[model samples]
Target chain A: MIKPWLRIALAGNANVGKSVIFNQLTSLNQIVGNWPGKTVERAEGTLFFKGYTIRIIDLPGIYSLSTFSMDEIVSRDYIAVEKPDIIINVVDASALERNLYFTLQLLELGASIVIDLNQIDFAAKKGIRIDVEKLSEALGVPVVPTVAITGSGINELLSTVITVTSGERKLKPLKVRYGKEIEKRVQAIEKLISTKLPQLCTVYPARWVAIKLLERDTDVAGKLKNYKNGKEILDYAEKLATELEKIHGEPSPVVIASERYGLANKIAKEVTAIEAPPRISLEQKLDAITTHKILGYPILTVAVVSMFALIFVGGNFLSAGLEFLFENLSMFIEWGLSTFLPRIVVDLINNGILAGVVAGITIALPYIVPFYIILALLEDSGYLPRAAFLMDNLMHKIGLHGKAFIPLMLGYGCSVPAALAAG
Target chain B: MQSGSRGSSKRRNPRGIKGVISLISLREGEKGVMAYAVGGFGLVRRLAEMGLTPSVEVKLLRKGPFHGPVQIEVRGVGLALGYDVASKVFVRPLKAKLDD
Candidate 1:
């Protein structure tokens, strides 16, 4: 009998090399498509492990599961609705604290997870140390350290996945405690939602949805509006918020975030060990000059201009080289065609379609490729945010703020993808 | 209630006239009729966060082409605000000080 397929999800923040890890796991066999009705791209691949085919889906990178942004909404919706068997939460080892914020939110979603501590080599080189065993024990999930770029720990990661999927390893869910009033509100709303929205009860934990509703989350509130008891739930949440404000003197959302961060700080201190303060590394020195108030804008302009200048000069040289090669190939093809085909047919193949296609490819590669490479380098080096910060005042004058700069910087690669991202 | 200033008060209304972009063009340090704050992260929000909220004293430093982005000094910070966002921000231009 064929074994049942197990679904796994790889999720993390942007620029954590999740794609690199996905490529390593899937090798040459991967399928890319859009999520239903959304512009976000979805990648699915399969691995044959331990006599069973395990299918892995790479979801979009998101900062938080709070439905503030569209990507966050899509990611949260997928995990809450689809209920994948396991979620591989890939985190950047160097920036564990910020990454752990998302991890805590993921835990709240109630999905089984395996934390993949990626970029261990870089972390070690920078004098950062993490105790994987202790981390796994604390989070109640298997923690695998990986250097996806160099293929380190990949096999062991795969083995861990197999072991966990096959029931060889068991992980208990980690629960976070919100304060007394919030807990009471969560329980009350969960009871009402469970009874009213029976169909969705199995999809997402009612308590999670209830917590979001009490935070005045428009997305969750809108989703629950069709239910018969939606109004009753809203009224109960408002009353609870009023009572809590009287006692606590703050809003529910702020209180919940503070609790989550407090828990994250505790977990971070327990699992990870630091030798000393982060040194003023090369990146910091570069940032000091590039983001400096006096010379910053001039340096940024020079860098951008020089990058474009290099692309233009290199394109001319490459185009000349390719032209010589293509000319010789055309001559060879012409001689062979003359021996077997008519003159008009030969002309059509050589000059009509083939020449035009070759010209298009040549133009696209030398010019477009270098520009894209520079943009990617800037993005990977983490200078784009600094650039946005410097240009914030200028952007505001144009009726947009610095946040819009993120999408504009992305547009350098492809406008279509940038538009989707901006949405 | 000085005798000479009493007649000037009738001619110059304390609540400045609600003129359009013309009022925004006036130099800073001039007294204004009323200043209103635009809420949220709109053009007004960005300017306000930078200490250029409506009703605050403003001086037009430079105006770009054809009612384009205008540079103004507000609370010691120089800012360039777009024409559209600036137009949305309502202000009553204050009268020029006697020393000026």
Candidate 2:
């Protein structure tokens, strides 16, 4: 008898086209549901290969598994507890240095991973040359080049996934070593947490939790509040933090982040190659005007006004055409009703519900669809971040930080999702 | 009272015209003469930092919206303040030509 389905996870940063790759792998065969406890959406799809069904899960986009954000917490929980058979880390080739920061954190989780170097086409056009073989060897994971949007190298990626999932390909672990003091503190905290909360064993690494506690992460402390002797555990952790801070002359989070960055830089230097600096291209010029300190706001205002103007002009014309079509359709429907039914029934069918519903759909389509399309385009183009940066000072004065500006700007498009995002 | 300081002139306007400096001018710390408030609770910290205590002298340059949301040049910088807060800031308007 064939074994059960092998579970695979697709993880990456936002805008890395993880969704596109997920769609490609499992075209129409997918299920969307919330994860067991969290409200975050989870998607699962099946791919049958070599007589075994593989279950693929698309996890939320997270910058790191360090648990600073809610998304990271959810992602870390899933990977640590669920223990998926393989993790396909889809990394953007153009921004490999930043992407590798998360890659190193994921490696420390000690899970099996395959790195998907996505957006090769765009990277190449920008003159970015990647050494995939060297990167794979350095990271100790199979690195596959892919243009997920165009479906290039996806087959190879799938085959590699299959191979890794099947245990035919073994990956050597990437060990990240911190300073002696941190390692010692990590070991102490890991022992305490493991002994105190064995039930949480599947959910979080004791060492990771210890590091977060040492950093004075309130979120983690709150989460572990129910554990036996939680207050004592926290006190001990705080004592350790005080000692470490005295030695390091900085907060624990800063020290740990510095160490992570140092490791990432070292690995990046070994695995990646940077060519001579390229000349400023068209995109850079556009970025300059678009993100200019002085010119950016005016340009943004004009662009927004132009978009509204187009929407108004196009909407009027489209509404007239839609009215004509709907009028003709209404006439056809009336004729059909009159011919097929008695007078009373025909009158009821024509006047009661169908007419109102059709009119509603017609009215909603033009405004709702166009507005949604425009908002989606703005989000996909990554213009929202620039808008946030431009309006940061104004937002900062209003008691909301600059980071909150993105959701507020997006709120202009749709309040529901924007509020959700802000929350 | 004698005006003894160099290049100093003293003139008084109608009573009860004061405002807080919202922004410091681009220039180095020059004593702000007038200011305004832009709404939001966060400005409390900024006002504290800028030494904008009550009973400070302020002159209103421009008022917007229902004769409110006034913009006053304070410490060489322009500040827009709301009407509710501006009413509380009492000022003695400068009678001399302080613009130079």
Candidate 3:
């Protein structure tokens, strides 16, 4: 008997090791594609573990469910509409408060979530200690602390997923409850949505829809406008939001965002304790010099020059080695196959396909490999952002922002990924 | 386009205007409490979602060398805001030393 495929999604903020976890679970079994009609890349991979085939989708990393960008909209729609069986929320343990702000939104969306507290070691180094059990209890979901790079706690995470999805263990995620002012309006809109447009409830939780409407989310508003009663609900939502604006003296979206942040801050404080006041670490020291007003420019120049210099030298050595090895292999193949096959066939097999492949690898792989490894190192080590910070002023003069420098720099190595990243 | 010195020097009556200065005006190591961000709904909402709500304390960690982005600490998170965006986020300095 074949077990049904278990669907899981890895969701999180940018740079929280979600991709690392995705790569860990899926290993070589992965396919990269685009989300239909959207330029956003979608990665799907499968893992077979413990008599189960699990399909994992890595959603685009985004900060909130708000439709600020195409990524946020795609993630939110996938969670609410597609409805994955389990969502592995990879949150940075070092930055729990800000990360939890996104978690709160996920909970609000009513997704079945397991919090992957990634980079726990980084948090520990910063003298931050988290009560994992307390956090699990607070969120009312299983919390797995993991260091994705080292593969620690990954097995336990899988086991937890099995236990939760297999019906042995149950998840009772905590519902986010806003303050009195916002909660009352949320309930009012939720009630109106349930009564007026019950069909919308089938696709989304009434409460979630109500909250989105209150936030003046254009996506939901557009969807609502299609329904006959949606106009009435939209008007009511606008009036209620205006009332909230009157009370808060800010836009409804800002009001709701502030309230959500307040709750995230509260939960983060409750579950985490700082063992020591922040002392300057080596990263901080490096950050200081690398981003210094006067020294930063010269250092950035040196760093860029050294990177290219290393890549060129390393690629040349590797290409020469591979070329030598492949030359002998091609000769052997030609000689070995000539005895059994025609000269033309041997030539086709050896010189045509094999030589072509060998040439491509020797020419392309050597350079691409070193360039990517160095790029990954720069990104993972958090130096790339600083480099961008240092180049911001210079980059702005060329009609671009600081972040534009990354793809521009990537252009020196390869135009394909650089163009994709620039988009 | 007000520089730090120029912005601070143009003193307004404390009772009338209250000393809420643009976030970029705070030099490195200076601390301020976030007032409200002034921008279109998109910008304000985006900043608020990143935990830059009113009353949260922010410290100017560093500024890009030449009128670039401003790196600030808000709610225990460090965020880099562009010059134009940073200028819209008004904050009240914790200490009133600009006058002295």
lDDT of each: 0.70, 0.67, 0.88
lDDT at B18 for candidate 1? Answer: 39
CA shift at A194, candidate 2, in angstroms? 6.0
What digit string (tens of lDDT, one per residue) describes model 2 on residues A1-423?
876688889998776789999998888899999877777888999988767788899999865665555667778767887899889999988767557767877877767899999998877766678899998988889999999999999989989988887789988857777888888887788798889877765676677778778867777798788876688779989998888879865456655655665666566667656565567798667755665657877977875765565554565567678878877876788898788678888667767666786666555455455655665676777675555556555665688754576456556654654575577
TM-score of 3: 0.87
Residue A416 of model 3, lDDT score? 59
- lDDT-sorted candidate list, best first: 3, 1, 2
Of 1 and 3, which scores higher on DockQ?
3
> Which lDDT tens digits does candidate 3 get at residues A107-215?
9999988999999999999889999999999999999999999999899999899888888888888899998999999999999999999998998999999999999
Query: Candidate 1's residue-wise lDDT over B10-89, tens digit each?
Result: 32322354352333445434433325433343333234334443345566654433444555655323455655555445
Which lDDT value does model 2 have at A257? 56
Residue B48, model 2: lDDT of 20
By DockQ, the candidates rank as 3, 1, 2
Please state the i-RMS of candidate 2.
Answer: 15.1
**Model 1, A286-363: lDDT tens per residue?**
866766666777977877667757666776778778787888888898999989999999999899887997797666
DockQ of candidate 2 relative to the true structure: 0.02
